[model samples]
Target: MEVSKKKPAAGVPAAKEPAPTLASGKYTFSKSEALRRYLSRKQARSGKRVSKAKRDEQKKKPKFVEKPFNKGTRIVSLKKRPNNYPCKNHSKPRSKVPKKHGATKVRKSLQPGTILILLAGVHRGKRVVLLKALKSGLLLVTGPYKINRVPIRRVHQKFVIATSTRLNIESVKIPDTINDAYFRRIREKRAKKAEGDIFAKKKKTYKVSATRKADQITVDKQLLRAIRPHPDRKILLNYLKSRFGLSTGQYPHTLKF
Candidate 1:
């Protein structure tokens, strides 16, 4: 025997059931009274409602309450006086003046006559000789001006890279005149220009003072004398004259400075 399948009527169509939606737009989930009542009953059954009610009752209680004097009062007395003899705090407060900061620690690699490559500034990449550290915590260095044109000046230790090159300068004594005060630029007070000359254009020129020239000559003389006996004297002078820089294939990290 043969079997056949049945199909829907031609003029009719299938319909989909509508999903439930919330009436209020304030919340995504339903918060109907039935849901509130069910949650309240669940909390009550779980013993949370009792604790919440107790907290609310405690919040409603007065923090301080007055009582009748003789109802439950107890009598007490002090046997001796308390130890607050100096109650006004007569002691002095700590000093407000700040303590002076100690000098900057010199690096172990730095010493008199040690060559240092300056990292930053107008004369950066130039090598200079370490003379001594100033009381103000700055390094006193010089390029001997004759070799690299780097004058005797102060530089922060942080901005310098020490090299392995060192010269024996036991005989080279830095003069006391070359302290921090020596490099300070003294402002010469110019006499007020005559009213007649006020409009005249005058050119201003700066020259190295005789004192500075003399000092540089003195220091360089001693320094050169010490370097003269060294085997690599010419090489040392050339090294100080040349500027330090990295080429295309070179990197600072791999270089053993």
Candidate 2:
């Protein structure tokens, strides 16, 4: 038999010599070591580096095999079955985030015209009449400002103590204009002043807007109309005017609001 020798092409390097084999016909170098040297030599001749991804693709990876307890058992190729046809979900995925500020439910004891005792804020311990519950879950209450100094304001239901005493305020019409949005104060864009000018200027007083004053007057008139004809009018007015407080030997649980 005659062996053929191929001539190397111009500008292209010749192939490397085959890896040395032992008498048993096995490579002297490990498969991985031989592959690494082959890639390095090929890269040097070509003057182009083999990318890690490309090198990894070219590398012969060992197949995963489960170890056998018995040496007599034949090596079987075990493959994970692909999920080509996955199980379909009949229900939608549950949302991770909850929606902000859903409408608050009204308490059974808290109703329109029910007098609530303020449990928090500057007006704490003052009695006020519940006009309605806002969409944001805040209760709309007023001091009638005539009976007490508590102005028409929004208070959380949790912060107010509901009384068994109820008034006939169904006749009073709450203006559609007065809602959660009504109480939101909009900041006016002011001209930027120098740091020195800020201190030089007199501290500005926060006066209630004209529209807010008008709204307060309008609501108060409606509330007063309902209160004027009540049979226990004098006592109710005195009760609202009084401040709620705990004295010596007095417990909240023992006393009813």
Candidate 3:
């Protein structure tokens, strides 16, 4: 009996042929060549030159991630009072001037017998007797000549005159006129007095005999311990010179002390 040949399956597709395997060969590479190849591949992978569009997109994205405030969060706010608050308080009706002994508003115009001290300005650190208070804000003085046209700004808060080595406020006086000429004259007189005092002391030094006999003097140990070269002084001076363009004086005394 003859039989028909079995038919192949209708839906099955043909399988692809396997690729041929490479033949085993002795592969060789120099150390430098192998390293160069590795480095080139690494650089090519890492150095991915970005396009401008990608960079712009990255920049447009928000950098920080914000979260909604939690229900438990608390808010606080503070407001500052204006600087004119005190002025407003003083304008109230009950703010009349008190009638106390030292509660006078005008301060009596700094009349004579009111000693005033030189508080600030060019005459700072000096004590002068106020002879009289001039209408032009000048001060007259018994010593150091009259300080012509001394401005009210130069006078201190309180004036006291030295009487018999005791300071008293009742003996002081105020002057009327304050002018450049008066100020110059007073300054000159003070300078002359200072010079005279200095010369007098120097002259006395020549006449005074030395009383101390030769003796071995011991140096203070504490002073020696403290007398180290300042570690920060050089660095600070250098910084000042570079930043502020300041120059130290040439005098050795000035440089150190």
In TM-score terms, which candidate is top? 2
Per lDDT, the best of the predicted structures is 2
Q: Give residue 237's lDDT in candidate 1 (0 to 100).
A: 85
- Badly placed stretches (over 4 Å) of model 1 are 1-95, 188-205
The lDDT, on a scale of 0 to 1, for candidate 1 is 0.85
RMSD of each: 21.8, 21.1, 32.7
TM-scores for all candidates?
A: 0.58, 0.60, 0.18
Better of 1 and 2 by TM-score: 2
Q: lDDT per model, in order? A: 0.85, 0.87, 0.38
Considering only N, C-alpha and C atoms within 3 Å, which residue pairs clash in candidate 2? none
lDDT per residue for candidate 1 within 165-211, as digits (tens), equals: 99898899888988888878767788766667665867667778998
List runs of model 3 lying over 4 Å from the truth: 1-106, 142-257
- Candidate number with the higher TM-score (2 or 3): 2
Q: After TM-score superposition, what is the CA distance of residue 252 in candidate 2 from its true location, in Å? A: 0.9
State model 3's lDDT.
0.38
